[model samples]
Target: MKTQTAKEIADNLYTGVVSRFGCPRVLLSDRGQPFMSKIVKAMCEILQVTQHHTTSYHPNTNGTVERQNHTLAQSLRTYCNDTHDKWPSLIPGIMMAFRRSVCATTGFSPFYMLFGQEMKIPFDIALEPKDSLPQDTRVYIDQFLSNIKMSHKIALQNEAAQKEKDKVRHDQTARVRTFAIGDLVLLKVHKFPKGQSRKLCDKATGPYRIEEIGPNYTYGIRRISDHKKQASLVNATNLQPYIRPDPTRQRLSQEDQNIPPDPDSDSDSDPEVDQDDEVTPNVDVEATQQPTPTPQQTPDPATRYQIQKVLRGRRKHGRREMYIKWLDGSCTWEPDTCFDQEMSDFINSRWTKQGKRRKSYFN
Candidate 1:
């Protein structure tokens, strides 16, 4: 989207001195907005500078300038530790630092290459100012440039060494044993039931087969259930190698089968018994037994009265609750204000029951 016009890029590259220092014959840039602007194109034509542009959105074609921008930003960030937004104000410092520094690829400072002699600055001055001898500004400039060149060379060497060290470490491979489908494996069960713990050895309790490698990447493994026909999935970390079952042991049914049945001949004899015969004489038909009639008692009226009394007691208490609610809060009952005797007794009983239950729980 940023179309840099040849004139605009040239203007920024040279700052305010492009026309004063003599215009470049050919200006190479990208099809950014500043370059594609009609005004910039007209300006380039008027200045009689040839304009060249690379493919759209290809920063590598204008790599040198983009790399310079990146360096300036990085250096600017380092200088503006507390006030990074003020980086624009420090653009002059960044540009001077860049120019004074030697080029990594070409091994020459831009200032030295452009002027055929380097520019002088405050950082590299060594000798005191003199008046007797004719002052040579060129010596001061050379010393300043020489210091920057040494620093740049050292930085490049350190970068190359760090890259080599990283490459050596990064190239090493991590070991992994890939599990495939239908392979018998012992499941490394990491989690278990709430009351159960997994302190089993690496030789843990399984000879399960891999039902599936993975359904998707989120779940990495599939294991067949030991007690069912179903399968379960697991991650790589939860898996372990299968251990052989114990050879010296047998199932409970097998052990029971090895035992012999008890002998059936060991039995006790029955007890001895005696018997006798008895006779009875016949009776007359006229002597027959008579049936006795019993009287049934009627229900008592006092029982009915007791039932009505119980009902009357409950009704009286109900009226008292309603009267208390109206007197205290206009018939809207609340815990704080409705304090009838019946209600207080009921509340106290319930609190007592609740307290007993709480104590039972703790006990």
Candidate 2:
């Protein structure tokens, strides 16, 4: 086929998809030129099909279709010559092979599930006995319908069992994260083009506030810095809880800068009160000396950085340093002295926002 324009795409969709399969309730696709064109939009509006586009960077939303396309391409490569221009001629044979193959989820071939009978392959017709007798018309019709019902029942049971297995495997390593209205979240950013170095690129943008929760685990996000405009719907996979920077750390850092030199220890020393100093009335010395709670240690609403991955066993100048990736956008190496036990474990845990099944545990 030649390069298709907007009108051609719409016309082909109406003839090949709508006419054949009837109107779809919803259409999900990437933001390709054909899908985004005005002609396609008008066709969808007229057909009453809700259109949804996946986010720019996250291609997993349409993973199933991508996988099928990969399968079709592989089949084509096996059937076509080196030139490959005539591969479209073999589409019918490829589709027939696919329809006859049993799916893992349904545990039935697409042709058998739809038509309630095995397709008559060329070999079946060529190798059949010439003297085979045929059954009565009424009896054949009744028997065919009975077999269809049985196949449908088996398909349903297989589908249910597959769903259960997937759920159990997913939940084993899943990290469940729930967001309430008014909660702050960091949106993962994808501005860099393909083939660019992403090692130091900013992975996320915004300490955005959750304006609304939409269906299908999508969250409506708006920038905290700019609340006037609402951004696109973000999937849970691309979002992570934001942990705000701790003020106490800054305060302690400042105090460390002003403290006088400790000639004995050769390291920074805590300020000490002289024995001759008089204690003030109504003031508890022990209470004043207690350490302030950090943002990570408390259930603070202003949390911005949630540690998701930890690269342990790293060293800086022969001292141990841990590299951590946060939910928002930080990937940095830090000394062990900087984090407490709780924070370290949280970083080490390979948690994701969507709670998807990971191969390490699921496999």
Candidate 3:
């Protein structure tokens, strides 16, 4: 009796058991409130259809539909095997692509059966119409039916192979760590000037004192702004340790003018020991001399900044257009424009190992 979204109800009608899927002269669903709702009943009415909520408590009668659900779910799982490990993020795209592609089920795709045409998928560039007539099509209908059966067998085998491979990969990477509470950590700020997220220059934006942590998946961060204590709990996937410009960080940048070259020439070289001893909370708050930031050749943007959304979250799946302000106790981040594609590629080309990098729509 659970209520469903309009999207959910429409999906049921489009791909559900009733949609097996000749157009319904009479529609049949359960006595669920969603189907009983005025909008839903109105749709059936508009189609000149009959709505039959099955006779109360007659569970045996709905076996055909229930069995179809299991069969369909299995088919769907086979169709979307998440082979690239990115299918979850690309679910909408994948579904959209699959729905519009040719299928073996009815000698055409679901799109074709419902809409009377198979849509040309984006990747099929060689698709061209042949000079075959619908009158000729009836002559070859039996061959088309035979082809559908063969295609289904081939697809099921491919899908099962893909699913097994995915299972193996999942088993292999089972140890990928999930974030837990009370761990000190660092977050990479999406701090790109002109909305560019590819800048390696923006990586170490925080030693952001982790304040409180969440149950197995998130952490709360607090940036020091004196009296204004601002905090946000972000997922652990978005965080990495703010490695504060380690000179020995395997690959050194061209920007080594900030810290002088390592001098093995001098002994008792314990700058770290000195700095560690001096970084007590009382000393930071109560001392006269402010701690000098680690020097770099290029003047970087001020690190501790507040970001604000210019757009509302309800639109576009909870992503917001944002502006960040620098917190060097000086206003620094210039936020006027969106840096879409060109700047991100420019930053990526700087990487020593410039493999393919995914461009997030959020960026």
lDDT of 2 at 338: 79
Looking at model 2, residue 221 earns an lDDT score of 80
Candidate 1 — what's its lDDT? 0.50
Q: Please identify model 3 stretches exceeding 4 Å from their true place.
A: 1-164, 170-175, 194-200, 209-220, 224-233, 242-363
lDDT of 1 by residue, 290-324 (tens): 12112233333223222111111112212221112
- Report how far residue 77 has shifted in candidate 1, in Å: 2.0
Instruction: Enumerate residue pairs that collide in model 1.
Output: 2-32, 2-33, 3-32, 3-33, 3-34, 3-35, 4-32, 4-35, 5-34, 5-35
Number of clashing pairs per prediction, in order? 10, 8, 0
Q: How many residue-pair clashes does candidate 3 contain?
A: 0
Q: 1 or 3, which is superior by lDDT? A: 1
Ranking by lDDT: 2, 1, 3
lDDT of each: 0.50, 0.72, 0.50
Mark the regions of model 1 whose C-alpha exceeds 4 Å error after superposition: 1-17, 126-131, 135-363
lDDT of 3 by residue, 233-280 (tens): 565666665434545433435564354423441212544455445444
| Deviation of model 1 at 122, angstroms | 1.4
Rank order (by TM-score, best first)? 2, 1, 3
| Error in Å for residue 134 of model 1 | 3.6
